[model samples]
Target: MTRLWNDPQEFVDEMVEGFVLANQGYVRRVRGGVTRSTASPEPEVSLVIGGGSGHYPAFAGLVGPGLAHGAAMGNLFASPSSTQVESVVRASDRGRGVLLSYGNYAGDVLNFTAAQDAVRADGIDCRTVLVTDDIFSAAPDSRATRRGIAGDLTVFKTAGAAAAAAYDLDDVERVAILTNDRTRSMGVAFTGCTLPGADEPLFSVPEGRMAIGLGIHGEPGIDETDIPSADGLAELFVEHLLADAEIPEGVDPATARVVPILNGLGSVKTEELFVVFRSLVKRLGERGVTLVDPQVGEFCTSFDMAGASLTLLWLDDELERLWTAPADTPAFRRGVVPTGAGVSASDAPSAAAAAAITDLDAEGQRDDAGADVPDSSAESRQTATRIAGLLRLVSDTVSENAAEWGRLDSVAGDGDHGIGMQRGATAALEAAESAERAGAGARTLLTRAAAAWADRAGGTSGALWGVILRSLASELSDETVPSAGDIVVGAVRGRDSVMSVGGAAVGDKTMIDALVPFTEALDAAVSGGASLADAWQDAADAAERGAESTTGLVARLGRAKTHGDRAAGSPDPGAVSFAALARAVANTLKNDTEEES
Candidate 1:
């Protein structure tokens, strides 16, 4: 369990701050995460790697000379935002290209791909190498679907070393790909991990049982069995990796030179790993495999998960050379490299990059946001005020039901949905209210709210809500108050935007389930000549029905997708929150319209 924190939402930020403060000799704080204290002197390839927090030495600890140039740290167990990645990239970019590497999680893929495109558009070359070494996540033929686990270390290390050795961007990328290909890991857990401020674990293993092939993000494993002895566990890991045929086709299993990583996920102390590693080495030697510099310690970890993983990196000549290269960071280190030999901090960021990093949240939220509000008619001002009221109601409703939402989400997902929604709604309310006080028009108010929601929430829900609000804002013109028809169009647009951005269909057991029905009902009612408030009420009711119907759904998307059966009979937290927000908006509309009348 997490022992200390101010706000759970701020945990990642505070963690990053403290990490930089402690490792000032190795890393410096950037907007996103951290960059090497001593930058590359020449425009050589830069290695940028990251994922969620909790995983210590695997990421930020690997940033330094002859290792990653920077890391983009996201919230705990969440992927960093594209903006965050771009900020880190720009902060660390030299004239040479950048190599982006991370565990192959869905959110990480989406955000990192977007960031890659953004940087390439800016004429800064960017390439990505996704680590997919967890063999049990998918069949051997479909290795692309496998999630990276402790194997993340090998790929990142190889790529960073290649970049440090002054390999071109293409070579750095190639090494990263090769490392991922040659690496495979399998993890087992005796218990599940708890997140900050959460009362329970993300998952649990029955007493005396063990979960096998678990993820580093506290995701439950795919297989289970009775707990095994240290020797038995080592044998289990070796058999799994060997049977998967992950070693290069030409490499013989009997004599392949490999770097074995015996990694403690978390709460599996160093002593336990050493005990396991002893058996692991003996088993490998008996199999006629030669081990080189086998690593034994925490690499990538889940927060306090009582588990460990074994990774085998079958090395080629180049890989073996890079694997042992001298490196230094707060956590990971090897042979020492010359100081002041790489890009220096004096290079810093371009003015544009600096601005993007500094104003990441604030710059995205504005419409005509400056204190200068164009003169608007009383009706427009009233509409803006109503938008503020809607967010206030949403904030209150979400705050009141936050715990229930968390409970429902905990049944299937990471259990942060409720608190995430509350944070976003509250932030949106404050931002919208401020916009209204600034005498902004309807569109400006909603746009401000949308940005604030996304900026504060910091998860899938946050990004989706931002898209929904932005879509709705697009419907309301700055000049006129929104009519029932306009509202209906906005709802439709919001629904479509959610689907487009979220990649979740109505039946995927996400917010889309409720959002689609709500929009349809709103459209139908408005077309039937219903008043705005009445139509909104109808939409809200439809949303509730849709949310309730989700109890029968098996999630096909997001975190719950892996535990579909376990999630049956529970409504998606996102869907339920959407329904609640719809009702709150409807209530606000009714009250405001009645007062005006």
Candidate 2:
């Protein structure tokens, strides 16, 4: 359990500040995360790596000369916003391009891709590498769907070392991909972890049982069984990893050198890791596998999860060379690294100005209020005012049912959905009200609301909501009043964007379940010549039915996907929230039409 923190929400920011202060010799504080304090001697590709907080030595601790050039830190178990990722990348990039790498989670994928596109617009060449090496997360054929775990160590090391060797952007990306292909990991947890200020852990195992294939973000595992002996656990890992088809094909276990990393998730003691590794070595030896430079410690971690994972990286010639290359960082180090004294700072000019965080971060994409807002007519401005009021209504509705939604999510997923919804809804309302006061049009007002919500929410749902609103905003014209047909088109665009980014269809037990039906009903009604208010009412009813359907479907994505049977009876929290929001918006439309009549 995490007992020390002022505010749970502010924990990541405070930790980043303190970490930079303590590692001033190695790194400097930046807006998104940390960058190397001392400049590198030669210009090399900046290796930017990041993910959610609670994983120590993974993100900020790895930023230095030979490892990551910068780290974009996020909130606990949530991906950093695109704003943060872009800020850190801008600060880290030198004349050479940048390589962004992280675990292949949904929020991280969306945020990092957004950052990549954002930086590319500024003429900086940037690429991305997603670590997908957890052996038990997905089947052999669906390797891309697997989550990253302790295997992150070898991939990062290979990429960082390749960058340190002054490899060009293409080669750096190639090696990182190669390393990802050769690594595999499997994890189990004896107990779950508690977020700071939370009274309970995200999910718990029975006293004598353990969860298998658990995620780093406190997600309950896919399966549970009675706890076994150290040897049994070691055998379990060996069986899964060695059986993986992706394990470097035709590599002779006798001649092939492997780097075995035994990573303790959090509360698991170092001694226990050593004990498990002891049995692990015997099993590997029996299989004629040669373990080289074996590491046993906490590489990546959950808050206080009593669990550990085993990762195996099969080494080839180039991989072996890069694996042994000189490296240095706050948490990880290899050969000797200079103290940055003799080397002139002119070698690497800093872009820290762009990376500086401010109170404006809370404003998110809304900071661009004066940037590219289209002109709006008086009639459109009136609609914007109505939209602001509707946003407030949605906020109130979400707040009223926040605790209930949270309780439902706790049964299968991390219990943050309700809080995340409340944060987004509240932020959206605030941004909309501000835009209304500023005489903004409907498009600008809703777009700013989307940005504010995504920034404050900070999760998978937050990013999706941003995409939805942005899509809808793009379809709206500020210069003219929108028609019922226009509303249907915008809503359809919003639904498609959510489905595309989230990769969850209607039955995936996500927000798409409600969103798709709502859009479908609206489109049908509009095509049949129904009024906007009447169509919205029908759409809201369809959304309610869609939300109810989720109670019979198992989740296929997000943290809840792995909680087999645990979430069987409850409707997905996302779908439920979307349905409620749809109803609230329907009421607003009805009220608006009545006023006009």
Candidate 3:
């Protein structure tokens, strides 16, 4: 349990601030995260790596001369928003292009890809290499879908080394991809971790049992067995890693040289890791595998998690050379890194804090207002005010049901859906209210709200909700009144766009399950000449049914997909939240009609 924190929401921010104060020699604070405090002799291809916070040393602690040029830090167990990613990329970009690398989680993929496209629009060359090294997240043939774990160091080291060597964007990307292909990791947990202010851990295992294939974000393991002795546990690791299906392609363990990293998740001590490493190294030697510079300590971590993971990087000549290259970072350091003609920390340029999506004053008053909004007509402004009211209602509804949604998500996910939805919905309402105060139109209000939701929420749901609203906003006109048919068309566009962006189908057990049925029912009702309120109520009812039906289905997408079986008896939190939002909107519409009558 995290005992020391002023506020749970402010934990990550405070941690970053303290980290920079302590390591000013290596890194400087930036808007989204940290960047190097010193400059290289000349611009090399910038290596920007990041993911959620709590995995310290992985992201911010790795930013320095020979590692990451910058890191885009997100909330606890959440991916950073696209706005955050863009900020770090802009600050890190020199004359050379930038290479974005991070774990292969759904939120990170959505946000990072969006940032890549945004920077490219400004004529900056940017590329991405997702770290997919967790062996248990997906089958060997489905490696692309696997999540990254402790093996992140191997890929980051290789890419950063290549960049430090003055490799172009193409070669840097190539080596990063090749490194990801050669790295494999597996993790086990003795107990789950608790987030700050949470009364319980995300998930728990029975006493004397150990979980296998657990994620770093407190996600419950996929399988469990009785805890084994140190030697027995090492045997388990060797047996699984040496299996033919688990080895990297073209690498024969009998004659291959590999770098083995034994990483402590959080609470596991260095002594325990050494104990495990002793048996692990002996087992590998028996099979004729040559171990390279073996590492045993914390690299990537889950806050307070009682667990560890082992990573292997199959080495060839080029990989071996890069793996041993001299580099210095706050966390991982190699042999002496030569001093370059780099600028000192005192002379380096500083960046202003990034504009927050959900801002607050020093006294904790809301500060998401005061932005200048777009122009609108009187009739459209009336609709915008009504939209603001509807958003307020939606925000309240989500807040009321957040705990239940979180419980559902914890069955198979990292259990932050409720927090994310709350953030997105609140930010959306704040943006809509601010837009309405400036006499904006419905389209302008929705557009602002959509951007805020995506930026504040910073997850798969956030990205999807932003897409839904932006698509709907595009169909509305500031000068004309919106009809029921127009709204239905917008909803259809939103639904289709979400399906395309998220790559999920109707039966994938995501929010699409509820969204599809609601859209279809609303369209059918509106086309039959029903009033907007009547049509919406009917659609909301259909959405409720759709959400309930997910309890019998298995998840085929997102974080839940890895533990699909565990999620079989529970409805997807995303689908449930969507249904709840639809019902809330329906109630607001119905109330407005009754008041008018």
Candidate 4:
């Protein structure tokens, strides 16, 4: 449906009014709907950032605290007017100078350049920092001309912080340039957002597919692929970022840390955002990339659409400290600062430190504390190993099934569910294996593995999986022994988290149908004082039955919804898969415990 707006002009005006009103204390609307931070003054330098309006908390939301001094907000999915840019520059001008920073979009470039000239005529010193951080936006040789995405956060944050710290205009511009040099972003969209007064979406992609490198404002993407899991998506984005902004040749991938922004473009839930973040972090870790600081939320949006963008900012000492600095705004706020003895000079972990194998136990398992503990339990290790193996199997199965399922569902629905599920499963397996190999406790292994899986696997299913895993892990983390009762509790919490985040109840044709009963049965068995194996057996059996029951249940959410009555007679694949996984885990646990005894 088109947005309920009186007219395009009125819509833009009203939006600007609301934004300024909402942020009155920290920001003020200058000419052309641009917002400027009241805190910014005539310093050695001035910072200006702007872009289309749809991506909120972006061009404007960042105009406070240690961010942009001023922002030129454009019309919905359109660049701001040149006059607006000029007005913002005048408002932001300190006698010392101004730096115009904006994305590398044609409309933005034209307007911001004109605004720069206008400011120069006014006898104000002004410069520009164009952000071109999207690797897929253009060929490598043409990267300078590529459109900016979420990397704008880093560019502005660094520049704003430098300006706030009283850096000269040239120095501030240099900080912005340095941030861009170390930043890259990539995104994929499953659907497009509609402009405020438009009935149709800004862009379109076939159902069950994703448009990789799609511009935030409905610009055409590089290509469309069957939607991938959060982990797969993370891998895709990370690979591109790493390749485009090659980590220094001598740097250890693991010790190399960066800031990650898992951004939702409206319509995507917080749960999904977490899933993407988890995947991004895990993948980066495996590749020797450490996460120095992370901001996960809807920093930018494209109305109500299903999609996400990943932004990575490789930090030097200066940028990292600036990023870590305290800031407050309506949309974003830094938490309590660490009791630091001053910021560290080196952003990269030392080679000697990196060489040391920290966090491993005597059994060759990694611990959270990064210390090796001997005499770790063999039974726990075996259980972790089995779970890891099962996760791998699940990943392989999902991938194989996704291709087949995608083809089958292509007739009536987007076919990427199969692929999405498979990729998520694969990512989960990798995380599980890694945690287990690190000598994590059984509970820790399951919890971390689930988090890893959910993070990498992107869609609704990925979110669900993430919730389940996180709930389970949280419950199990504090337990020393983790009896069947503990497992039951963890499962119940997982089921609850899934329902809470997804808003789906049992019999909704979502994974909850299987997960709810599975956990309930496990709880009952545990409370009745059944053996761990017995409780697990009952839970697995209940899950299978629950999954089978979904065959007759009409789909309520997700791709199955489009199937209508046809979705009946086929068990929800998510439910079926959940049951299968539970059964495998139960069997493995039983066999392992018996062998140990």
Candidate 5:
């Protein structure tokens, strides 16, 4: 359904470039995403908000005075890598502390938390407030587990307003948490969204039917029913929202003041939203509820999804004030911006921020490029060349099997695993090739590949793969060729690193299922005096079995977990990809052994 694109792989980057070009007064391009182009005279707490790139106004469009200072844009429906998040944080930081906010997806949590820690280590005070407001994702008692939907606006707006008012880091975080606690949202879709270069939508409802409680990432809904009229849909929304269980604690629906946000997901027009809002307002008024600052339009979206979500933020005195505060972002504007809130375009300082960011990024790249290469033995240099070829094999295998991986992921997840793996592997291959041509040895080449995979791919798989390769690289030597024993130790380290970093166990229905078995089998074979190639074959077979076992298991972690048993009959795409990669490497090793014989 995404028709206009020069190259599917470059879609996000191109989209960001165009957004910056169009909104020069509001935002400027940074390494990761965009930051405010205009600087305030005094330092204030920076609110850095972001997630995947498809949710237009939810992120970059909200960067300006009285809103987010910057946004860390990720791939379509994927979380940004930690490197990307950190880059955005540094670019946005003033003397004041920083607050990071985003939807509470697993990948976002992992990446943002890592960035927070990284900045804190550099003496920058940083905090995180996750938006968990989609009522259908979790029960009232388990609200903290819910994923954020359109309610992201309520949290980000309140936090950004508090920061603009010169509130300290602690208060900004507090208000953000308070806003998230009061907000509740639900979404429905008449159809599904299709990713670029994909042949079909991620999931589809039957004709004349609608999917209820679907995620913004094109994930299938929890239930399907016949389409309802505008009034009926409004009633459905009001009934579910005003339910005693769904209402915020200590709030009386009959006497509450709420900010109602009627958000179009993507393809739905403003006219249709107004039609629904008309009935919705009447229903709320009849129940004695007072609505203030009702917003109706596209605030968050899934690319071309014919759906919408309703979000309600129960407002107290403080929250009401913050909610209605002035914000002059590209998409969201409220009241009149205070004078001196931002610098004028011709003020020289406006260009300084962009120039400073570009210089810092260039400096980092130069440091990496000019880092001294460690001396290597002749055997280790030859092994590095072979490793580069093996990386190319991985890239080819993942690219060839990407479609099947995407299909498997669509059963419950956002369906980007295949594309992510392909991007990471290709980037890793390119980095390895460049490092090899630079006369780098085994450890240095792998380190470069690891960083490239994480930086280019930007997701959960990308982060974990970077960890795996980095751990393996640590075990390799520039001075001598690595022995089978060293490889086994490295495999064990990679497994441990993945578990520690991803926080997934073997039965959690993640890539760990296959990775654990592969590492264990390789360790056993090597310990029993097997050759590296033969041991790798045994490990690959074990990984295949582990991946197959996931077909009967329910996901207990990550995005798929929200769908409960919907993923039970299909192998996790992550586990399947791990098995495939292991097998591909094994095949390459077998060929190498045959040629040597």
Candidate 6:
């Protein structure tokens, strides 16, 4: 399915307009959507670059005082025309000359070469340097012809420094080429990116498998392999770059140094990136390479692909100095600003000082050492067990109804919601049981259970469940006993928190339909001084009625949005699940209270 866009051309044009507006003070938009550095208007040399959109902070994003002077922006995954490149060159021209630096691709080379001829004819001196550092892009024998990857950052830094230091255009071109030669990068993608107006992904990878050496524009990779653990993936990526860069095969006992860059493609989390970094450092040390000045984060991305790339730039004194130079841009900033030179290692906090300052137990209460701290009260244990039972029921219900829900989602949604809900419910039940066994408080048990559920089951429903439970736990912070009034207050606060965070309401065809009425009825019954059991029964009945009403309403949000009118006459599964949970809570409360009395 194609994506919905006003028009691809207009979309690209408007985006360029916004980018130029945001960077106007620091950089100026030259002809053809190329941005030129405003700080170095008359540098001894100038660097002109160009590339496709979506790979932000690459060609255009690297334009600044200490990077490329100008960049010709292209359409997403499409090359810019020769004329467009020439226009950018003319706009960035200085008396000294201009250097063209770009990835090694046939289309880019052909276009940039034509632009170079045109610029030379206009009496502006210009030269070109191609970056080919992707080891997977070409055979080892033809590595010089490979496409550039994350190593583009190293190339820009080197060339930018050369230009800023008053090197002529030729000198800057040489520096860029040298950096490209010394750098190498490789990446793997678990999933492909989606280009605007394109329903189908730009490329495809088999589920539970990854494409090694995948191109940013959806091109086929060298091989497909079963997905590895984060640590394993890190080792594979590091091995590829190190081999290509020809880091010495044997470890030197003394004076071995290297710089490692761990980059996220787009959608990977910072936590995952750090995990990869930890593994990479361990492997590098084993190889006798001392990591110096490591840069780890999303320096480059391929839209929202779920993957990462590793780039290694062998650092020398000159390269290291240039890499450490003061440079600031929207996405990257680093410099050698001095700090606290006199601070010694002994002045840092000792291990004993870092120990807990309070004698509070995990539940945030005094430990009272040698005194018998009470286990969870019988009422609290019952409440926790009821929650665990409810979660188990929901998990079973979801598994049984998976086929029906999957059929509904097949038409418009991803068909994973049922599975996601089942997984989350299972996790919640497990957490609740564990917390109860540990004698945790009501609030702590609920919070821990919810966090476990959300972390184990990714997606919208998991997040919403986490919010609801977290809000409920927060409301019960000081209450030792949960009366019907306390339940109503917690439910109301939880409902409000979900609405505020998710921007959904009673008629949004979301779980809010059942949740809103359940909380409202509970509040009303409690305010009228009904018994706790009676109030819970009333709220459960209202929740059931609200959930049933959703059968006639068309879904207007989330994956259901694509169903349009077809979603009508079918109750939202989220609302149904919420109603089921409300009823379960009411029944549990009544039975437990009767037993206690």
- Report the C-alpha lDDT of model 2 over 1-597, residue by residue, as the tens digit: 788999665677799889988998888776667778877777889899998888997888888877788898877777877877877887788768999999988788988998899889868899998999987778888888788887888888989899888899999999999999899898999999887767778888999999998988888888888999998999998988887375677687767789999999999999988999999999999888898889999999987999999999999999989988888888888898654652255644444434333323534644334444557899889889878888889899988887778767777776777767777788788888877777789988888898888876777888898888888778776677788898888888888888887788978889998998899999999999899899999999999999999998988888777664678888999999999888988988888789999
Residues 1-597 of candidate 4 have per-residue lDDT tens digits of 445677543465688788888877667766555444343333436677886677887877777666676787765555665555666666665566888888876446655776677567756688888888777766666567677888888888888778767888888888888888777788888877665534455456897889887667655456789988878888887787777245533445556768888888777888987887788877788788778778888887765666888888877788888888766555666744222131122312233322321211111222344532233476766656665776776776665455444343332233334544654576567666666666766666776666445433434565567667767666653225556666777778878777776667888886788998888888898899988787888999999999889878887764345243656776777777788778877887688779989
Could you say which candidate leads in lDDT? 5
Model 3 per-residue lDDT tens digits across residues 1-597:
879898765678899999999998888776668888777866789899998888888889888877789999987888988877887887787757899999999889988999889778877799999999998898899999899999889999989889888899999999999999999999999988887767778889999999999999888888899999989889988887788998888998899999999999998899999999999999999988999999999999988899999999999999999989988988998887655444554324333222221231111122434565567788998888888888899899988997788778888998788878887888888888877777779998888888888877777898899999888898887777899999999999999999988899888999999999999999999999999999999999999999998998899988888999999989999999999999999988999899999
Residue 206 accuracy (lDDT) in model 2: 93
TM-score of each: 0.93, 0.89, 0.93, 0.55, 0.96, 0.54
Best-to-worst order by lDDT is: 5, 3, 2, 1, 4, 6
- Cα error, residue 203 of model 3, in Å, equals 1.3
Local accuracy by lDDT, each model = 0.82, 0.83, 0.86, 0.67, 0.88, 0.67
**What TM-score does prediction 3 earn?**
0.93
Report the C-alpha displacement of residue 445, candidate 6, in angstroms: 75
lDDT of 2: 0.83
Candidate number that wins on lDDT, 2 or 6: 2
Query: Which tens-of-lDDT digit does each residue in 1-597 have in candidate 5?
Result: 889888777889899999999998888787878888887656789999998888888799999888899999988898888878887888788768899999999889988888889778867899999999998898899999999999999999999999989999999999999999999999999989988999988888899999999999988999888999999889989988888898888888889999999999999999999999999999999998999999999999999899989999999999999999999999999887654534544332234445644543532241346545678877888989989998999999999999899889888999888888887888788888877877889988888888878876778888899889999999998878999999999889999988998899989999999999999999999999999999999999999999999999999999999885999999999999999999999999999899999
| lDDT (tens digit, per residue) of candidate 1 on 106-167 | 66776677778988997888999999998877778888777889999999888888988889
Worst 10 residues of 6 by lDDT: 357-366
Q: How far is 179's C-alpha from truth in model 3 (Å)?
A: 1.3
Q: Once all C-alphas are superposed, what RMSD does model 3 give against the true structure?
A: 3.3
Q: How close is candidate 4 to the true structure, as a TM-score?
A: 0.55
Specify the highest-TM-score model's number.
5
Query: Which stretches of candidate 6 lie above 4 Å from their native place?
Result: 1-5, 244-256, 336-597
Per-residue alpha-carbon lDDT of model 6 for 229-264, expressed as tens digits?
989998897677666334533423245666678888
